[model samples]
Structure formats: structure tokens, C-alpha cells
Target: MSETTHTAATTRASGPGRLLVAVYALFAVAATGRSTVQILTRFEEAPLAYSLSALAAAVYIAATVALARSGHTSRRVALAACTFELVGVVAVGLFTLLVPEAFPDDTVWSLFGIGYGFVPLVLPVLGLLWLGRSHPRTPDAASSAPPSHRG
Candidate 1:
């Protein structure tokens, strides 16, 4: 890759990006676990609830993968996934609150992510903001200058 591209890629993978990736990984694990337990034990009781859990798991998995990959494409994918996650959390939260019967059994968003200390409620928003602030690297002015030719 060209130096420009390399710098861009490196900046995109900065400390905040790594931190977000870590959080995404945690969500992946939590969502996977929640869905697996719901599916194995009580799927028959509330297919919709369990299915939603599975969907949450899938979203988190996608976010984790996308964030961990470095490139323009991966950044776009990660942004979209995080946005969708935010929407899902809000919509599911409201639905759970307004129509308790809709969720015969609790899924992850049973009480606006009360079970998860609302990290599910807040993480995506933070992720989006972080993504927005991330800038690709550019050559520093000093580095861009040609070396002086002295005797």
C-alpha cells in the first residue's frame, strides 16, 4: 500500500478504535450468551423474544468483525452496524415497555437494557460518536519537507 493509504489505515486503527473494538467484542459475547440460553431453554415459550435475542447477537457479531477489520470498507460497515444497533436498542426498549405481553419472556432489552446496566442502551451512541471523530492520518508538515542539502 502507498504511504498515504498506510497512514490512513493506521490512524483509523487508533487507540479509541481499539477500545471500541473491545467493547464490541464484549457485546458479541454477551449477546451470544443471552441468545444461546434463551434458545436452548425456553425457545418454545417465546419464539419472538428468543429470535430477537438471536438478532441482537448477530448485530453485535457483525459490529465486532467490522470494527476489527482495517480499511475504508470496514469503517463504513462498522458505522452502519453501530447505527442499526442504536436503533434496535431504542425500538426494542420502547416496545418492551409499551407492550409487556409482546415479550412473554424477557430478551436483552426487557427493560431498556436494565439487565445489562444499560450498556446496551448507551454503547452504540458512543460508538457512533467515536466513529465520527476518527480521522485518517495525513503527512506532518515537517515530515513532508525535503531534506536540506548542506555541504
Candidate 2:
């Protein structure tokens, strides 16, 4: 017959998890501020870029929220947000390369996130990697069964 037991252990705070949270937070702030500035300063000059900036802000906000939550639900949301961010960066970067005039002003993703020191380009990649690393262990693996004491 199989036996089951449970024990207590203190899991250390995840360094990558914390880093992920921080990066997401930074994006949240940057995207929000950039979008606000663009919308207020010259929205008509580049409506597509400005609108994309708003979308970028929303995605960053969602990513931050998801990373902070750190549960099944939040993980899913984070995955989605990261995927969208990657797609957005790649698509926008390519578009800007192929169609220069199409983008009269800069958005968060313009020129592969050049304005943000490429952090915007790299963040989602790191986010996805961290997400994979932080994936929840299975029940058997996560079990806290006490070590056997037989000598």
C-alpha cells in the first residue's frame, strides 16, 4: 500500500520572479508615460504610433499585474501578454523597417525599442524565460514529505 505525508518547508523568494516583476513594473511605467506624452503632445502627427503606444501601455500593465499575482490565472495572463509583446515588437519593428513613412512618430516598439535602450525588445524574451522557469511543479514534486529517519 502507498502512503502519503506532508511536511513544511520555507520556499525562498524567487530571484527571477522578483526580477520579472521589476521589469514588468518598469515597462508599465514607461509605456504609460510615453503613451500619455505622445497622446498629449502630438497624437495627430502619428495616430498609428500613438495608438500602438496605448496598446503597448495596456500590455505592460497587464504583464505587471500578472507577474505580481503569480498564480495559475496570473501565469496564463502573463504568458499571453508576453506573447503579444513579442509579436508586437517584431511586427512593428519589421513594419518600421519596411515602411519608414508609415511611422511619423516613435512608439514604444518603434525601431525595435531603440528609444528604451532595447530593454523593451529584450523584456518579453526574459519574461517568457522566467515564466518557464517559474512554472508550478507537479503535485508529486511539490510534496513536502519529511525525510526518512531510519538509521
Candidate 3:
């Protein structure tokens, strides 16, 4: 007889999350590659933008792994990364638009990810939703417990 052990190790990345992971992983690779080339060859041209790209790449990489791992700690990491990604994209987008001079060169989030079909701008939103839905409800913590008799 085969034995099956059920645990919180299972992740949402199996279903629709599979698509999410694919997207995040793709962005991670793309951003990492882009930032590395920009920073290595032309750091003086746009240090801020290149650095931001590197940060975004790191966040994407973290989020991808966390979401795919699908555990308590992993979920928290994914949530934080998604939140930061959203904030970064919005902040960078606004800054680039409000003052074009602020960014000497384009980062992954420039123009709200216009260069990447806006996937970068929208990915975090989906990730957050997936994380929320993936949250594990304790099996014996709340509803399963007997109701306490109130005085």
C-alpha cells in the first residue's frame, strides 16, 4: 500500500499559479539579464535605473521561488515581494513620467512596463491575489475547536 502524507508543502503554483510562476520566472530572467548588461557595460550612463532594474530582478526571483515553494514562510516572502514589486512599479512609473530627467535610462518598470506589454505592471496584482487564495487555513485551529462556554 502506498502512503500519502498531506502537509502545507503543497502550493497554489500547481494550478493557475503555474502560469503565474512561469510569468514571474520569465521576468526574473529577463530583468536579471537586462540589469547585468546595463550595469556591467554602462554603469555611468544610468546607475539609478540599472540598480533599480537589478532590485526588481531580485524581487522577481524571490517571489517566483517563494510562490512556487508554497509554505508559511514562503507565502510571507511572496507577499512581501509582490507588495514591493507593485510599489516599485508604481513609483518608478510615476517618477519617470512626472520628471523624465530623473531617469537617465529605462528600467524594467519604465512607463509602467510599456516596453514589456505592461506584464511587469500587472504581474504583482495577480501574484497578490494568488497568495491570498493560497493561504492555508489551519485545520484544527479555529472552526474545528469546540466553542468556549461564555460566562
Cα lDDT computed for each candidate against the true fold: 0.81, 0.79, 0.87
For candidate 2, the per-residue lDDT at 57 reads 93
Put down candidate 1 lDDT per residue, 1-151, tens digits, no spaces: 6666555556556687788788888888988998998899989999988998889889889888877776778778888888998888899999999998989987776677888899888888877777666636577999999999999
Q: Write the per-residue lDDT of candidate 3 for residues 25-71, one digit (tens) a residue.
A: 99999999999999999999989999999999999999999888845
* All candidates: TM-score: 0.81, 0.81, 0.87
Task: Flag regions of model 1 displaced more than 4 Å.
Answer: 1-5, 137-151
Model 3 scores a C-alpha lDDT of 0.87
Report how far off residue 28 is in candidate 3 (Å). 0.4
C-alpha lDDT (0 to 100) for residue 133 of candidate 1? 67
| Alpha-carbon deviation at 146 in model 2, angstroms | 18
lDDT string for model 2 (1-151, tens) is: 1121111001111566676778778888988998899899999899999999999999999988877773566778988999999999989988988998999988889889998898878999988887776565546643667667798
* Candidates in descending TM-score order: 3, 1, 2
Cα lDDT over the full model 2: 0.79
Winner on TM-score (1 vs 2): 1
Worst 10 residues of 2 by lDDT: 4-13
